[model samples]
Target: MAKILVVDDELGIRVSLWRALEFSGHKVTLAKDGEEGDRLFRENPTDLVITDLVMPKKEGLEFMSGLLVDFPDLKILVISGGGVKASSKDIELLLDTAQTRGAVKTFAKPFELHEILACVRDLLAADAD
Candidate 1:
């Protein structure tokens, strides 16, 4: 089993994702925002990171860029609800930037649980090789 970190601002999203990842047999850690997410990551590295693109304190892109500097090979899966303040086009642009910054995958909010689980599995399997 892989150690996975789920970083999100919404309580429901964080809890549900933590539950799903735990149920899938991976050791998981939860963080409410990128600031805490950054600390958690440095404290204990994980096989993968699934984070929301928009958050308070620090956004996913910022957190991710910092991590990439030190852990260039880190695997990151980004998710976003387009923020309450952002337009659809803004979200798309942000997600595109995340991809350029090294997110292995990006999912818009309302993405299926199955899709996430499958992507996690595939990424871990690929890493195993």
Candidate 2:
């Protein structure tokens, strides 16, 4: 199983993601915000990062930028409640920025558990090369 880092400011979201990942047999790390996420990333290496788009400590895009700069091959998944469809310009920008930085997948909030699991599996499998 891949080691995953989940960064989100919402306590409920963090707990839910952690539980889901743990149930799927993946090693999971939870962070309250991007600052904590960065610190954890440095202290303990993770195979993939799953982060919320907008956060208080640091924006997810910024975190992804730094993480990608430090670890180019890093597989990342951007999750956002902001972008439901194509109309939300800010969400679109965030998604685009993350994609440019090497995020493998993007998931809109209220995402199904199966979808998240599938995305994680796909990303890790691809990384296995």
Q: Which candidate wins on lDDT?
A: 1
Worst 10 residues of 2 by lDDT: 82-91
Instruction: Please give the lDDT score at residue 94 for candidate 2.
Output: 70
TM-score of each: 0.97, 0.90
Among these predictions, the greatest TM-score belongs to: 1
Candidate 2 RMSD to the real structure: 2.4
Against the reference, the lDDT scores of all candidates come to 0.94, 0.86
- Tens digit per residue, CA lDDT, model 1, 1-129: 999999999999988898899999999999999999999999999989999988999999999999999999999999998799888788889889999999999998878988999999999999999
Flag clash pairs in model 1. Answer: none
Backbone clashes in model 2, listed as residue pairs: none
lDDT of 2 at 112: 90
Model 2 score (lDDT): 0.86
